[model samples]
Target: MSELRTLYPVIEPYETGWLDVGDGHSIYYERVGTPGGTPAVFLHGGPGAGISENHRRQFDPARYDLTLFDQRGCGRSTPHAGLEANTTWHLVADIERLREKFGHEQWLVFGGSWGSTLALAYAETHPKRVSALILRGIYTVTRAEIDWYYRFGVSEMFPDKWERFLAPLKTPAERADPVRAYRALLTGTDETARLEAAKAWTIWEGETITLLPNPELTAPYHDGHYALAFARVENHYFYHDAWMEDGQLLRDAHKLAGIPGVIVHGRYDMPCPAKYAWALHKAWPDADFHLIEGAGHAYTEPGILDQLIRATDRFAG
Candidate 1:
């Protein structure tokens, strides 16, 4: 555990580049760690968000070549929230583009939360191209999962926060369909009303992230861009039902079984509990399952660090 005592993982020089997938779409990505090292890619969560710098630290620079990227309409990617050519299919295309851009025979795919959904979708559609998967906090992104997130499960636990989130829905029709609830937030004509909606949306999301976010996160809520991008793409995903259904990944886990996989989940993760990983394991018994005992949905959970390191090390091996 001597490797664990550190403020930040050692970051080697990293490169940021933009890949054009044509049709006026480009993806922002960062390449780091050793040259010609085993290829390891990082996938960020948030269907409509930027990849955080801290997330890139989980991989060991001494061990593997690391790649981190913002999905279309996110992070350093251009036309943020334009949404003209952004979808799960577009994202899967971006993954393939990266594989060809880097000239890798196959690359390791690492993702968390919503990213896990994208990785699963990508691997399922392009099974022959993937080398391995390092997935954390499995989220299949089914309608059941989205309904649980927006309507029933987590909200039932955090009623007050849910009330605050639903406060903007002045009309019964709006409350009945979250799509209307989101339209009021994202497309409201009044700037003040837009800010109000952004506040509620951010609050609800922050609440899900291990209770209300700390002091640091609240400031971003005041800025419309974060909330706008978040509201835009999240609604896109929720409206489209996250593009996957029950047992979908399971139906094709065999294609990836020949490739390695490591699934890490927190037993206490309320947002997406460990049960999802257990289900995936039921399909691909060979996939490694690392259940974090005391951790919740938050990524800073110590078990996440350990399991992530183990996955990276496994790739090194």
Candidate 2:
């Protein structure tokens, strides 16, 4: 059997800066890898998770020019965790602005999890601007997807973690609808309540993303500052359904026709069911699809990461 792939050696960004994306939001962005190589953009998940150093290692630094940025309210973006004017469309526009700023006519778009959702939105909205696509852990943000993670599906699989997730919400109604419940606390006036709820919300995702418990992955979710932005921005987006119409991404799959693409998904992905990834593969038949065994939702999983790096390397040509 072939050896599993892993991240490229850690490399620092050659250039980094902040973009004033308006609506009182200043986005933090960085450029890495060869300047004149294949142009590509990396979209981080969580709609709130922001970018991390590991994200820069996914592509071959010698072959691809990559741009990664923190969306509206998360990471180093100003007004930390602010929700105003932040939506799926706002982010899509921000991507375009960055693309224009870089002067790339079109670039490969690579995203995983929620990043997959944004990539689809952006690519569909401006198909002419995408040279290729590489998506992983496919998520369309439909009601079923949201309910699976926050309400019923994953809850049944991880009852112990589910219990901890529910401990923050006291009422039957809140437990019944945790997304809205968390949103209320996250956006409410009570700072203490907000931070507490944030930890619960963030921890739930951190612990559950991997098939196995990974302290290194889950530890950051517990930090009060990180959790607040993660939970608040994530909840805000979820509560609003990412401002996307039902089944919008899938329905627009036709827009992806003729684009070079790859889909990498874990068979046992919890936050994002494998079914949706299968659905996307069916919708975009031209794209190569890999259903990895012994993996979960996180891009860091061995099988998933191997497939992801393979996809990027393949597209780097």
Candidate 3:
């Protein structure tokens, strides 16, 4: 076995600003690492979970120029948690706009979890613009995948946590379709109901993302403000099935044909099952795949992060 890889170091963005992607959406973006180096973009998961400072350290700062941004309604993006004009496709276009803004003909794209879903969508839609891809905790957002996390599968694995997740919905019918139930509460005019639903939804994910209980990791999910956007936007995306046809991403895997890629997944991941990542590997046989043992969904998990850092390092050259 070789030594595990870790994040490079804490580095601040040399440039940062907001881009008005229209539709009342202005996404916050930042640039870090070497200027005019090998270009790359980082996509944060959650559909609602925005970028973090740690994300900037995933690549070799001296060798790659990386861009990280908040999606339509999350993070520092304006209209925080606003669901209008925010969908998988809207995010895809925002990525292209960012690439053009940076004047990069092509660049590496790195995403984890929901980020992986978006990366696949963007690469498939515009294959020629992607130089490489590094995906972790692959989540295709298929109906089965959605139900697994929100409805049934993970519910079995974390029964205690599942109960807390279920507490927000008081009835059997609402419980039967948690996504729909949560969406109603998240979008409802009652501020108290919205906040209650938000915390429940966000905390469920935070608690289950790791193999063991990680209070540090799960703490932020409790924040009323962050949870509101994280839950609302995330639930909104899942409720609509990300506006994607069933298994659409896997159906279009061939679009990644010539692009260099790496797929890293945790064997114990709960939010995203390893099976979908396996399916993606089979579909795009050209990409290297690693089923990391003893880890869960988060990119911070040691084994998953090791492979991710290695992929970025290898692609930097």
Candidate 4:
């Protein structure tokens, strides 16, 4: 039997600071590992979800010059949860700005979920700047993918949760388009309605994100601030389709042809079906693909984490 691959030891960043990216956005960034090492940047999931120190542990402290940053309106970045000028294009530009700020010619890009979407966009726009990619829970932010999770597809598997997710919508029209309905409440002026809608939206996600149900994670959604930002940002991006043309990422796969990369996906991932990963592999056959048999959407799942660690170890050079 193969031994389980674990994350490198917990390591603290030697440097941490904010990068002023203009437009009233100052991104929070940290550098871990040796001062001079293989350059790698961790692109966190959630077009709005931010980074944590645990993200820094994904790389070898001695071999990788790991950098992690909270994108606009996320984590420790200023103007918390501010969405102005925070489109996908802005994010791609931010990645480049970070690279230029750090003076690295090229660096490995590691991302998951929405991060995968941004990674693809960044690599396509600035191919020469990305040496490789390590994507997990692959999401292209296409209309079909968004519709699958939010509209009708995953509902079949979790009818109860879906019903609870829809409880906030009173009218048939609102129920007909949950995405738009939730978006209205999230962006509405009524703070109570917004927080209520945010809780309902977040609870539905927590319930379905994993193969086995864990209701406890939904507890965090009670914090109106966290719930508001997470739900609002996610809904905003999904509503706009991450501001990309239909099937744009798959159409742009040619740009990643020579870039060595790995796609780590859970076989039973509900938030993002495995077929998306399969489609990505078909488009970019050069990239290594691994399907963890007993995992779900979380990158920290045992099997998924092991595979991610292995991929990073392989690319540590």
The RMSD of every model to the true structure, in order and in angstroms, is 2.5, 0.7, 0.7, 1.5
lDDT of 1 by residue, 1-317 (tens): 45542224656446888988876877889888886888877888777767776776777677678788888877778787656777888888888888888888778888888888888888878877777888888888766777777777877888897888888878877877765577656665787787677667765775566432555644555467777677677777767766556557666777666767888888867668566778887787767888878776656666766777777777774
lDDT of each: 0.75, 0.94, 0.94, 0.86
lDDT of 2 at 213: 84
Please give, for residues 1-317, the per-residue lDDT of candidate 4 as tens digits.
79888778888899999999989999999999987799999998776677876788888899999889988887788777787888899889988988998899999999998888889899989889989999999998878888888888999989988999999999999988888999899889998998899888877776777776555544555566766777888888898888889989989999898999999999988888888899999999879999989898987788888988988888887
Q: Candidate 1 regions off by >4 Å?
A: 1-13, 188-191, 211-222, 245-247
Q: Can you give the lDDT of residue 83 in candidate 1?
A: 66
Residue-wise C-alpha lDDT for candidate 3, range 1-317, written one tens digit per residue: 89999989899999999999999999999999999899999999998999988999999999999999999899999899999999999999999999999999999999999999999999999999999999999999999999999888999989998999999899999999999999999999999999999999999999999987778777888998999899999999999999999999999998899988999999999989988999999999879999999999988899888999899999996
User: What TM-score does each of the candidates earn?
Assistant: 0.90, 0.99, 0.99, 0.96
What's the TM for model 4? 0.96
Local accuracy of candidate 2 as per-residue lDDT tens digits, 210-298: 98888888888999999999999999999999999989999999999999899999999999999999999999997999999889999
Which wins on TM-score, candidate 3 or candidate 4?
3
Off by over 4 Å in 3: none
| Span of 10 residues, lowest total lDDT, candidate 4 | 213-222
